[model samples]
Target: MSERQRYAVLNLPAVPEVSAIKIVFNRRSAIIITFTTPEKEHIQG
Candidate 1:
């Protein structure tokens, strides 16, 4: 039997615009990434 190596890859798709990016630490102290897009503004208003 032969052993083969496995790998995992993560990629972010192209974004037209990244208005804002925020990094926060929650109660658990885990890093969280937040993205604010143009679409969000229309919904918020």
Candidate 2:
């Protein structure tokens, strides 16, 4: 017999036209980050 996979859908709110987003990840005492602009451009650091 095989198990079924479940998935969930997330509905995110609309971002402001002039807003920017940032994401950060930490691994083994190192930090990686990403920046996003309102125009949907990704900046890596």
Candidate 3:
């Protein structure tokens, strides 16, 4: 299976529309998601 397929299995977007998503797994077994907006797009945080 490819990386894209792994994301699909988790029901996550492989390519986000407006921003980029960063997935982090901490030592505490917690999932952290970070959204980073591009300079070209206007995203309301």
**Number of clashes recorded per candidate:** 0, 0, 0
Q: What is the TM-score of each candidate against the true structure?
A: 0.44, 0.32, 0.44
Off by over 4 Å in 3: 1-9, 13-17, 39-45
Please list the C-alpha lDDT of all candidates, in the order they appear.
Answer: 0.49, 0.44, 0.59
Model 2 backbone overlap count? 0
Worst ten in a row by lDDT for model 1? 1-10
lDDT of 1 by residue, 1-45 (tens): 112211111133445675755655678965455668876732221
RMSD of 2: 8.7
When superposed on Cα atoms, how far off is each prediction in RMSD?
A: 9.4, 8.7, 6.2
lDDT of 2: 0.44
- What lDDT tens digits, residue by residue, belong to model 3 across residues 1-45? 478856664676565554666666689956666656665444322
